[model samples]
Target: MDLNLKDKKALIFGSTGGIGRSIAEALIKEGASVYINGRTIEKCKAIAQEIGAAGFYAGDLTQKGIAANITGQMITDHKGIDILVTNTGGPKKGSFLEVDLEQWESDFQSLWLSVVESLQKALPAMSAQKFGRVLLITSLAAKEPLPGLTTSNGLRAGLAGLVRSISNEYAKDGITLNLILPGYTNTDRLKALNLSEEKVKEMIPAGRLGEPEELADLATFLASPKAGYITGQSIAIDGGVLKGH
Candidate 1:
């Protein structure tokens, strides 16, 4: 249970709220120094204060310069990051034919390409130290392809493929790259969708949506030394909602 994570540094994207913040809190609880990232400085600072002296990075990762800026700042402050949690907001809900080319490109940049940049920035240090945990917080839509989330479905699936390929390339370097697919978590975004809690619970086999902490716990474990053998996997934390193995 120690997780052996003390003193390790983590850079978690989209940490202003929801699952990303949950992951940051869990990492801090495990004694890891975490850099919480968000687009605005105020939100980042606020969350960092609430989470206890967390390092904060404010940037829009969808913009090319912002990723480098964040990585640069972190390196200057803490030398390098050991764990990278690549998480972001999902694309707008719409059918495949409804989404335009710009929407597709933007979604790819926000949800998938940002991970590529973050890894490129953080990998050298992790490889040099022979210690790294790269966990991409994806969605069950990557596999199940929900009707209203066609953009998310396509982009997240591509993200899964990217993670799979990199897991193979980096396993020998002591870097474990894996994807965590979550289903129906209770978050502000989900709440805003306006479905009754009971109605949502009925759809999932577990009879309830997953909690942010539940997904956070899985991410923490995957980022730990104990999960060294779990690379190249698309592990679903969907409470049996995902049917297939």
Candidate 2:
């Protein structure tokens, strides 16, 4: 499986660490000209050099206009992007009623609105080129609600609808849009939660946490020309944590 990604230009958000960093590394290995992005310039720069990325972009996605600005800058500088991946940290963990009112707006701004803005700026260019791959790195909470993740559950599900709507409209343009749902992946973010790995493993049929590289490989494949026919779909890369399709 060549994946046929060599020479393609890719821009990935939240690539400084965790799943995003792993995906960027995978794309570079597949020969894509990858651009790493994060809120911290030094971190993104260091990671870009460490992974042999083509470049780096720094901006806080939670702020309005930042994503669009980054996309616009990327297009102007690199001509156009063939693969675009949007990912960010999840909102603070809390149950529905326990979350503060202001937190909802902040979550929407970072987790959802930023993606909307980036796509609005990039999709037209992709349509013109008649070649593109758009991947939204969401969570398994999109399909199944998780305790203490009410914000993620709500916004991630909304992204599924967004992917379906946009994919249908753009497929004729040679652009594919889809979601990759990661469940209990072994990453620093998951480790920071302070949850017992044994307890978590017990809940999953596979009896283990997914590796970051495993999810990264799935994303790399989806971002390649090989996955052109697979669009408007949500694929989960969990360790059989999701009981239903």
Candidate 3:
């Protein structure tokens, strides 16, 4: 199916690796001109080169001014973003009691504030164009808490709340805001968790960890021109790991 994303410009954060990289590659394959971001210029450039249809931007989204600067640069080059994929690295695994104030603040800023900053810069142009797709990559933990992911559980829930409110406010203006929750996708991050592949398969009803391409395909659809009516929803691509409605 043609996503109608040919020539659409997308800016993807945390695209150096993992799920973010998957999304970047998928968008490029769908004919979108993508700008990939990472903390290091070399990594971003290397990935962009490998992906073939992407540009590279190296900036620390955790830094106060970096998000604005990247947004401004994208606008200057591409006029504005047609799609924005908000993503970042997950925080260190631990319980709430094990987290300190610094960890809390840092996680909040990286996981939530970075999205806020980028959207603030991109929303006006999106409104003016009368077309926009903002896809936030969150986790199932947002709705179903996990034992060792308190930071993600808390921050992603807040991010979903923000998406819900923004989707309502922006829907009338022809913009769609939504969140995509990816549960146990097969990526480097998941491998780092060190569960045996067989154990992962047993845990998920689908009997396997999800492929990055699977999540990326869904992200491409969400950002497609045909998906305009899907705003204000948090759809999970979790291989039935989340049984809740």
Cα error of candidate 3 at position 218, Å: 0.5
Q: Choose the strongest candidate by TM-score.
A: 2
Against the true structure, what is each candidate's TM-score? 0.95, 0.98, 0.96
Candidate 3 lDDT over residue span 155-192, tens digit each = 89888889989988899878998889998888888877
TM-score (C-alpha, index-matched) for candidate 1: 0.95
Give one clash count per candidate, in the order shown.
Answer: 0, 0, 0
**How far off is model 3, as Cα RMSD?**
1.2
Residue 15, model 1, lDDT: 87
| Candidate 2 wrongly placed segments (more than 4 Å) | none
Write model 1 residue lDDT over 1-245, tens digit each, in one string: 78988988898988889999999999999999999988899989988999974678888866765666676578668987788888877668778788899888887788877877777788887888888999888899889987688878877888877877888888998899999998999888787666788877888989988999999999999999999999988989887888855
Angstrom error at residue 4, model 1: 0.8
Please give the lDDT score at residue 29 for candidate 2. 92
lDDT of 2 at 168: 89
- The number of the candidate with the highest lDDT is 2
Clashes of 2: 0
**Model 1 local distance difference test score:** 0.84
